[model samples]
Target: MTGAKSDHVAAYIGLGSNLDGPRAHVTRALHELAALPLTYLAEHSSLYASAPVGPQDQPDFINAVACVFTRLSPLALLDQLQALEQRHRRVRQRHWGPRTLDLDLLLYANLEWQTPRLTLPHPAMRERAFVLIPLAEFAPQVTIAGKTSATLAKHHDGADLHRLLP
Candidate 1:
């Protein structure tokens, strides 16, 4: 499905926040993602709570994934996502550290691409339950690295991940 029509392509973005009212941050980011130019917020997973992936002293994170239909090129999409992060005052104090907002371009119409700036199928998606489980909720049948989203999600432990009330 990498050869979708030129007008639009379906892409997935992973959203997460751990600083400054994370749930509100994620909710606002969802609205902003929908408002992006040439993009439609197709669907999203419920908010999920998970322990921090890096430093232990930080607060838990709120996470979710979104699927969108977009006419923008992959790099352009990346630029928009980065701009969104910056708008939320995202910081890079340390790798996997807490943030106000984090957006990851997980997939783009099944295309496999690599640049100094981005990677398709997200290099760490398969191994992260936070990404796979939420991704499977909207796109269970999608395949990545030879396994479907449902399959990957089903196999992950996700012991630290829990869905939040709507």
Candidate 2:
């Protein structure tokens, strides 16, 4: 999907990786996101190390959040994210299983909608410290469901999240 001509919107994307040189996968994905046509990366959170949310047998994840300004509609942006993931050899064999890269659309200008292909505000973001902690770094004041990222992050006090880089 595409947006109105030249109408840029701010979007946040959640990134995580636990396989295939995880840190390099994330770093390279950031560059790919910034290079997407009609989009510019606005900000990015520091890299983080977090316990895997599912299937604990896998490696821990390196995660972060990135903010971008883009003319693409939510779905189009999602397509771009998936393409980048494919470029990094992401495979969808198991739910929340380890992967070379995972890119998620966390928010798009506060617009909330759902389709078979995507969901706004990421349905599970609020409950996951992996998403919230890094998101708070770049968007401390941004609210989801009336709660700031920082405030929401505090709710996940037991989540195993640690900053890995500035």
Candidate 3:
């Protein structure tokens, strides 16, 4: 399913930034993602300012989720995400460390698979309040692992997350 089209699968991307111009980086990341081939930006959640999830010493992160229509397979989409990270100079030097940008494939339509490089429904999405809150905004009816968006939101760790802008 490398280059095949699957009726323009609906995909969700989790975006975040904590290093250098966090808000601007997130905003630019959205535009860059919208510019990718075979991918259409469908909707976006309100940007939120959230406390750092891991290694809490870093700066707070600006987070949001985006819905997109893409003909690219999951792996291909992952490739694009990594490329975007590189463009933002994101370094995985430390786990959950501060970065210029972070783009995660939170969900990929009705598809699910786990590979060394990628995982569907994003392995820890449910545990991350930063992802859950924004995702619920744009995909309140979507379900994953038999869990509704509302349920996921309820299960979040009650982190500090608030919309910075609409």
Per-residue C-alpha lDDT of model 2 across residues 63-133, encoded as one tens digit per residue: 98998899988999998899889989889999989999999999999899999999898999998998998
Question: How much is 40 displaced in model 3, in angstroms?
Answer: 0.5
Q: Give the C-alpha miss distance for residue 82 in model 1, angstroms.
A: 0.6
lDDT of 3 by residue, 18-132 (tens): 9999999999999988898899888888899999987988999999999888989999999999999999999887988999999999889878899999999899998888888
TM per candidate: 0.95, 0.93, 0.92
Q: In candidate 2, list every pair of residues with a backbone clash.
A: none
Ranking of models by TM-score? 1, 2, 3
lDDT of 1 by residue, 1-166 (tens): 3434568889999999999999999999999999999998888999999998879989999999998889999999999999999999999999988899999999998899999999897999888899999989878988898889999999888899999999
Worst 10 residues of 1 by lDDT: 1-10
The C-alpha RMSD of each candidate to the native structure, in angstroms, is 2.3, 3.4, 3.5
Q: Which ranges in model 1 have alpha carbons more than 4 Å from their true place?
A: 1-6
Best by TM-score: 1
Q: Which stretches of candidate 3 lie over 4 Å from their true place?
A: 1-6, 157-159
Backbone clashes (count) for model 3: 0
Worst 10 residues of 2 by lDDT: 1-10
